[model samples]
Target: MRGTDWLLLWTLSLLWGGSFLFVELALEALTPLTIVWARVALAALILGLALRLTGQGMPPRGLWPGLLVMGLLNNAIPFVLIVVAQTAITGALASVLNATTPIFTVIVAHLATRDERLSPAKLAGVGLGFAGVVVMMAAGRLEGAVPAMAACLAAALSYGFASVWGRRFRQAGLAPMATAFGQVVASTVLLAPIWLWVDRPWAMQAPGAVPVMAVLALAVLSTALAYLIYFRILARAGATAISLVTFLVPLSAAGLGWLVLGERLEPRHLLGLALILGGLALIDRARAARPA
Candidate 1:
């Protein structure tokens, strides 16, 4: 990956890292489906306006099928799964499970694509990075959280497939912003009926100011803006590489806690950071050694 790709990856990590907090807050007054629906729906509206303001047209109709698949894999399924899992488990454990995305991506991409074959270095790096996440988060007992843990793992696997599947848009020369907008719009469309049936937002009391703000942040910053960077990195860095953002997400979350909540960074955090960075470097070096 290039320097810009790294920058985008870190930026995306920061954006998505905060999403766990947002979802937790939103859940105070909203159900999982309601939060997921509001996220994609409002993100769609924002991205649509962004498209119109930038004079970028809607994605061509031919791309609709792909967009819908992307929506399902990337947004609807994983978003709902993660949110629901968070209801049963701490976000730190969820994040640790989420970091397995790249491991799944590596395997999926190896079987599903001609390029991006699995490599020993990549495997080592993924293992090291995952260990780093476990160390940094100190993921505790899972005595009663098996289902939620499974949900998180399932979400990570969905994300893995989505990363590989999304490469088609880049191959087809779609702009990142347009692809982002289309997927979110498709997700909103897909979730609307389910949200109506399950959440019945019309009958429920309105959420409090904090929860409402959390939902808005989830939509605008985490969903809309984050997807823009996501697709860009996907186009530039390939699926397995982009999925490495999951490893960095915990670091970003830790940084945010330290900065915003005055949480002290422990020595384990530094050790974990070192291990994660080393893993990333090994992966990059492996990529660099590959023939063009």
Candidate 2:
């Protein structure tokens, strides 16, 4: 990736990394389902307006199935899991665990697509990434709670599949913005009634500024701008390069947590992060050695 692309990736990473913190704040007043619903709903609204404003057009009919799958995997399940997990884990730690998405994406892409075949390098990367997760789980003294960590890991695994699944849209001739906007709208439509029935958010007390800001941040920055940047990178960089942002998000999250939120990072967490980065390097090295 070019320097500017790298900057964009890191910026995307920071936005996503900060999402955990925002979710945690929102969860104080809203249920996980409610948070997920609001996030996609608001994001869809914003993107819909933008699409109308720019005359970008709607997604193709052939792409709707893929979009629905991506919406459920990428937006609904993982979003809710992360929010629920935030009630139990520190935002930084959850971000680190979530960083494993690319590793999983590599494995899933190998299984799902014929062209995106996995090599020994990718296998090693996947193994090493999982190893890092195990090490972090065993070695780190994390704040919040333990079960939440498990939930976050599950969410990361789901994200891995979603990342790979998302690539199908390109073949369907849908622009990145179209796919991003459509998927959020799909998720909102699917989740809204469920959210209302389950969470009954209207019956709850009014949210304070912090929780309101958290929801807005999740919707605007994390969902809307994040997806815009994601598709922007996808259009320019291809899926593999775009997915690399997964590896960087943990570092950005940890740094932001420490600097902005005053959260402490234990030594084991750093060690786990090092292992993940090393695993990513190994994957890249393997790819470099492969004959075209």
Identify the leading candidate in terms of TM-score.
2
**Which residue pairs collide in model 1, if any?**
none
Prediction 1 global C-alpha lDDT = 0.81
What 10-residue stretch in candidate 2 is worst by lDDT?
139-148
Candidate 1 weakest ten by summed lDDT: 257-266
Pairs with backbone N, CA or C atoms under 3 Å apart (clashes), candidate 2: 88-145
Tell me the whole-model lDDT of each prediction, alpha carbons only: 0.81, 0.81
lDDT of 2 by residue, 163-198 (tens): 788777876777778888988988898898889898
**Model 1 TM-score relative to the real fold:** 0.82
Please list the residue runs of candidate 2 whose C-alpha ends up more than 4 Å from where it truly belongs after superposition: 1-3, 139-144, 236-241, 287-292
Question: TM per model?
Answer: 0.82, 0.91
